[model samples]
Target: MRKLARWHIWLGWLAAVPLLIWLGSGLFMAARPIEEVRGEALRRAAVPMPLSGLVLPREPVVATKLALVDQRGRPTWIVTDADGATGRYSARDGLPLGPVGAAEARELVAAAWNGTAALSALRRFPRDAPPGDLRQSRPSWQATFADGAHLYIDADSGAVLAVRTRWWRAYDLAWGLHIMDLQTREDSSNAFLWLFGTLALAMALLGAALLFRRRRTATGRRA
Candidate 1:
């Protein structure tokens, strides 16, 4: 029993801070509505555009899939090749549309943004260099709005990829801490998490044992 107390005390000192952090972060995450945390209101609803009066590209490319959608109020073809390359072309003339430039990216985000914040800045990320927050390997334009929400636009298709709000980034940071993934913040199966989780469980079990032991001692004394 004495050895158990010593072990519990030592483990308590080691795991207390982490446990509190876990609890606090978890509660902070759970307290808010998931939709708000995800910034669903900031996204513009996608309207389905009919594929009528279309002209396909005759560039002798093997395409795995195709989508005809309205981009900037004009019918466009988004072609997906067998090699996983995606390109946007004009459905009006079947000519390949150029990749989204900085001006077009800013205009796209501003027009599509449902939020009232004014679009502030747009930065282009080339295909060879992708932003860390995007988590996808493709050319993109990151647009910053006045509300501190970042909207990502596909550089090729001029499509809205994602809208990450301030709250969303905060939650992401907390998730990294909770999962114990300091490096990439994507790996939940890290060794550090497993080690600390095991220690926490052991500490809990020892504390339970001590509680039962104290209760049994009290009952014996009364008898």
Candidate 2:
């Protein structure tokens, strides 16, 4: 009985350090805000761009096309989709500025050609509009640009209403690291987390069983 108890205690102690380290790190990360981490990663990944001459557009323009225009309206970096169904992103900053849908595509064309209501609204609205004005009732995704800019596009409407950057680069970087794993799909990456969790549970169960066996043997000896 004594030998069994001793073994269980030693084994439990042996597992304790790694378990604590893993748990503590996880809890600390969870408690921290996501935005801070994401911002940090963005800062690290950011690349500088030249202020002069014609800017070149980035590849994979199928997702989004980006063009840099000067005050005179001459395009320095003209990024547009050949199919015209997708959006365009600036090669310099990777900031998506245009999206294409039936209505959205028309809006983009009008904004580019006629300088209509949509363009007027976009220009009039504060670049960093108040949170209350931008709040929506639906789920949406936001992306940070390489030039420390942010673009919030409505998922349902596909309208980009606001674009600006905040100083929380570290938070954003941390979030990106936490959510992005090497796996192609997010679910597969999550499986690794579950695997570690299961290991911890099995270790706990084995420890409990050893303690129970020790108690039983001691009781039998006394009886």
**Worst lDDT 10-window in candidate 1:** 45-54
TM-score (all chains, Cα) for each model: 0.90, 0.32
Which has the greatest lDDT? 1
Best by TM-score: 1
Give a tens-digit lDDT track for model 2, residues 1-223. Answer: 5665566566567656646655554565676556543333322222244565443545444425543443123333444356533334443454454533345433432332311113222222222443332333432334433454544444333444344335333333333344433332234247544555555566677678777887898999999
Q: What's the lDDT for all of these models?
A: 0.83, 0.43
Tens-digit lDDT track for model 1 on 1-223? 9999999998888888779878988987887788998788988876676666778875666778888767777777888887767888888889889988877777788667899888888899987888767767788999888998888999988877788888888888788888888668899899988888888898999999999999999999999
lDDT of 1 at 69: 68
Candidate 1: give the clashing pairs: none
